[model samples]
Target chain A: MADVPSMEALEALLRRLPGIGPRSAQRICYDLLVRKRNLLPQLATALERAHAAVRFCERCNNLSEAPLCAVCKGLHRDHSLLCIVESPADLRAIEDTGMFSGDYFVLMGHLSPLDGVGPEALHLDRLSERLAEADLQEVIFATNPTLEGEATAQFLADLVPAGITISRIAHGVPVGGELEYVDRGTLGRALHGRRLLDE
Target chain B: MADVPSMEALEALLRRLPGIGPRSAQRICYDLLVRKRNLLPQLATALERAHAAVRFCERCNNLSEAPLCAVCKGLHRDHSLLCIVESPADLRAIEDTGMFSGDYFVLMGHLSPLDGVGPEALHLDRLSERLAEADLQEVIFATNPTLEGEATAQFLADLVPAGITISRIAHGVPVGGELEYVDRGTLGRALHGRRLLDE
Candidate 1:
C-alpha cells in the first residue's frame, strides 16, 4: 500500500535502519516532528558526511576517513603483533576490551568460497604483503568462532609465513553467562585450550 | 557516576524513546557510526526541526508548523461537524482509520485534578468560544477511556450546547488483540457498545 507523502519518505528512510519496522519508522518520524526540527538537518549532514567521508583503511581495512584508521596510525600500538578481525565492528569489539595493545588488520569480510567470496575479495593480498614487509612476530586470529570464521583462519594460516606464531582468542564460557547455557562445542573447545592462571 | 561529555545526555537523547534503554542507546551510537552515518543528519534534523519548527495548531492545539494545520485549512474536510480528541496522536489515529470525514478540535490535556491539570490548562475556553460561533451538529468525544479522559469528556459535555449531539467511538477488543489479553474494564465497555452488524 502506498503511504501518504512527507511521512512516507521519512518512514521509508527509518525502515532501512537495523531494527526499525514501518510502524516504528512512523512513530520515530512523528516523534521527530513533535520534538526536534532544526537538529534534523545536522543529523542529515552527519549521515551524508560520515558515509561519503569514511572508507576502509588502506593498510588494515578498518573504517576510516584518512588513508589509515586511528588504530592503524596510532604510535602506541605494537606493529609486531597484529590482531585479525572480520569487520570494523569486530575491531571496535577488540578495542572495547582494552586488553590488547597490538595493531589490527581488519579483513572487512570473511572468506566464503560457497558464496563466491574468495581470498581475492577480502584483504588477503594486503595481509601477505604486510607480513612480508613488516617485522610481524605474531598474528592473532581473532575472527569469531563461527564455521566460516574458523575456515577463514585456517585458510589464512596456510598463506602466512611458517615462523610467525598464530593464536585464536579464548573460546570459553562467557564471563557472566551460565555454564548450563553454554553449548557443548564451545565447552569442548574451551577445555581443549585450558590454561594455568598465575592468580 | 558522571559520564564524560555526558554520555547520559547522549543516552537520554537515545533512551527517551518508548522501548530504548541505556545499552540499546550505546549500541545505536555504535551502529550509527558504523552503517547509518548517512542518515544521522536527517535524524538530527528531524529532531531539531520538529522541536523548532512545530507549534500547537492555533485552532486545535495539534502539532503543526503554521497557525492552523494542513488538516484545518484543507478545503475538502467537513468544517462544522468537529471531532473532539485528546491529543495530536489521537487525531492522527482517527485520521488513519479513514472513517471520519469531519474536522478536529484537540484538547491538549485531559482533566486531572490529582496531576493538577484542569479545564483552564486544557484550552477549554477556546473550544467553548469555537462552539458558540460554530454551525456544529455533532461533537465526537474521542478522548481515551481512562479516568482523566472520562472526567475531561464530562467537563466538555457540560459546556456543549443542548442542540449538539455527543458521541464516542466504541471500545472493545482491538482487531488483532485477544479478548483474554484485553483489560476487563475495556472489554466490558467494548461489549456494551458493540453494534449489530449486517454481516
Candidate 2:
C-alpha cells in the first residue's frame, strides 16, 4: 500500500542509512509514525541534539562535541602512541577490547582510486603536520586489510618522516581460529610470522 | 570509544526501531552525523511533519491526515464489505495484494489477557456501532493466524448480530511453500480444507 507523503519521505530518508533496505525502512517509518507512541518526537529531538552538538575532533578527526575528542583530551591516554584507523567505529571496536591505551587519528575513509579519493582527499597533509607536532614514538596503522586499506597504509608509510617508528596491525589467523578453517593468505601470514617460545 | 551524549541518545532511540540492532543504529547515527551532510535536519523535518499530519482515521482507525482514511473516503470501494484487521500494517499488507476492494476496521491490537487488553481496549463497542450503521453484507476477520488472533476473531464472530455473513481468511501452506518444509499445523489445515478439482 502507498504510504502518506510524510511517511513516504521518512521512509526514503531511513533507506539511505547503512544496512536499511526498503522493507526495514517501511517498518521503521510505521513504527515511528504509529506503533510506538511518542517515538518520533524522541528520535527527532535526539537527531537535532546530535546535529547541534557533535563535531569532528580538531586533532584526530574523530567524532566529538568539543574541539578535541575524548581520547585526545584524556590525560591517561598515551600521547606517544597514535593509532590510525579508517573510522570512529573501528577506533571504538579496538577500544572495546580494553587492550589499547593510545590516542587515535581517524582517516574517515580509505583511499580508493576508482572513487577518485586519494591522499589529498583524505587530508594527508594535515596528518603529516599532526605527526610532526606530536611527541609520538610509534604510529599503528589499523586500517582494514582490504586492498584499498593496504594501499592507504603503504602511502602513509611512504610519507612517514625519518626516526619515528611505524607499524601495521598484524594479519594472521584469528586467536581461536583453526588453521583448516582459516583462509590460505591468513594461514600463510600466521606461519611466516611465527616466533620462538624462548624469545 | 564512548559516543557523546547526544549521539548516544540518538543511537538509543534508533535502536528502539524494529530490525535496528546496536551496530546498525551506530552506523545510522554515524551516517547521519558525518557521512551524509545535512541528513539530520531532513530526517527531523520529515519526522515532525509525519507527527503533525498523521492521525487515526475516525471511521476505520487507520492512519490518515484527515478524519477518514483513504479507503473509507473512497466512493467506488465496496461499502457493503468490511475487513477487520489487527493493525494498520496488516491493512496495508492486504491492500498491497490488489485482491480486496473493501473498507476496513483496524482493531489496533488483539485481546491479550496477560497484557490487560480486551474487547473494550480494541474499541469493539465502536465497531458494533459502525456495523449497525453501515449496510454491510459481509465482515471478514483478517487478523493474524495466532492463538490470540483466533480468540479475537471468535469474539467478534459472537458479537456480530444476525443477518450478516462472517468469514475468516484461509490458513494453510504458503503459496510457494513445499509440503515437506511446511509446518504440521499448516499441512493439517491444508488437508482439512482441500477442495474438489471441478468444484
Candidate 3:
C-alpha cells in the first residue's frame, strides 16, 4: 500500500502538541492506527467538544464554559485574598495544596523579554480592571521563581495601588528532597530564606 | 468553571492513549485548550480521518489503506524470501536496515502462554497456506530474542514442512556495544555464533 495519507496527517498534528517530538508522535500515530480503533472516535469527539465548548473565564482567565471560573464564582472563597499565578496549571497546583482559600487570577504567561512577551501579551489591562473592582486586601504573587516570573511579579506589584499587602510563595528545597541532590539555586534560596524554628 | 466539562472529557480520552498517564493527559489537554487553539481542530480532523482511512494490509498484515502492503505490491521485492516479525514497528525497523529486500509476514504479537497467545493467535494457518503455494526458498524469523519471541520462532520452525529452509535472525551483542557492559546472555550468544575471519 501507499503511505496512508491520513496517518501522515495525524502524525503531523500530534507532533505539534507540547512535549511530543516527531518520533513519539509517529509512534503514537501508529499505535492509534494499530491498537486503538475503539478509542479513536471518542478521542476525536472529545477534542471537538472541548474546542467548541471551552472558553477562557472572563473573570480569572482560567478555562471555563461560563463568564467566571469556579474559584471566581465560589461564594465561600475569600474575595479579599486574591492570588495571582502565571497559568491555569499553577492555579490547579495551588488548589491541590489546599492551603489557599482565595480566588485566583491566571496571567496565562509571564514577561519574557527575549521572547517579546510583555505585560500587554499577558493582558495586564484585564488584571487592572479586576483589582479596581474587587475589595481585595492581600495580593499573593505565586508566579514561578524563574527570571521572567520574577519580573512579571515585580511589574504586577508596581501596578497594584498602595496599602494592599503583597506576598510571594516560598522558594527552597522541595519536600522529600535530599540536600546533596538539590540544585545550587534552590539551596542558595533555601539558605537565604531560612526562618527560625517554631520550637 | 468547575472542572470544565469538555476539558475533563478531552483529558479522559487522552489518558486512554498508550504511554499517556492522567497527569500528562491533563497537561496536554490544558495546553491544547490554552495555547494550541489553531491546532486543535486540525488535530481532531486528522484523528477522525486516520480512524476512517487506515486499515491493515491484507497480504502482510502491515498498516495500509488498500488490499496489499507496499512491499507485497512491489514487483522488485524478493517474494521468495519472507521475513517474520512480531509487530509492524519491527517490520519498519528491519526495513530501516535496508539489507533485507524480502516481503514480510507480521505476527502482530509474540506467543505468550501466560497472555493466552498461541499459534492460533498469530494465524499460522494463513502462513501454512502461503508456504504451500509460494516458491519461497527462505523464511527468516526476526522475532525479538526474548523468551516469548524465541518460543514463537521455535513454534514457527516446527510448523514448516521438510525441505524448506528456516532461518532465524542472529542473537548477539549489538554493534558498537562494549562486551564488558553487554548482558551475559547476549555476550554468550555473540561468542557462540562467532564466524571465522576471512583469509
Clashes of each: 28, 0, 2
> Which docking category, incorrect, acceptable, medium or high, applies to candidate 3?
medium
lDDT for each residue of candidate 1 in A78-138, tens digit (9 for 90 to 100):
8889888987778878888888989888786788888998888766778888877567889
Give the C-alpha miss distance for residue B53 in model 2, angstroms. Answer: 0.4
TM-score ranking of the models: 2, 3, 1
Error of 1 at A5 (Å): 3.1
> Model 2: C-alpha RMSD to truth?
1.8
Model 1 / residue A156 / CA error / Å: 2.2
Can you list each candidate's DockQ? 0.24, 0.69, 0.70
Tell me the alpha-carbon RMSD of every candidate.
4.9, 1.8, 1.9
CA error at residue A79 for candidate 2, angstroms: 2.3
lDDT at B191, model 2: 93
Q: lDDT per residue, candidate 2, B121-188, as tens digits?
A: 89887898878865788999999999999999998898787899999999888988788999898899
lDDT of candidate 2 over A42-143, digit per residue (tens): 888888889999999998888898898888888898878888999877888898899999888889899999999978777787788868855888889999
Q: Global lDDT of each model?
A: 0.73, 0.86, 0.85
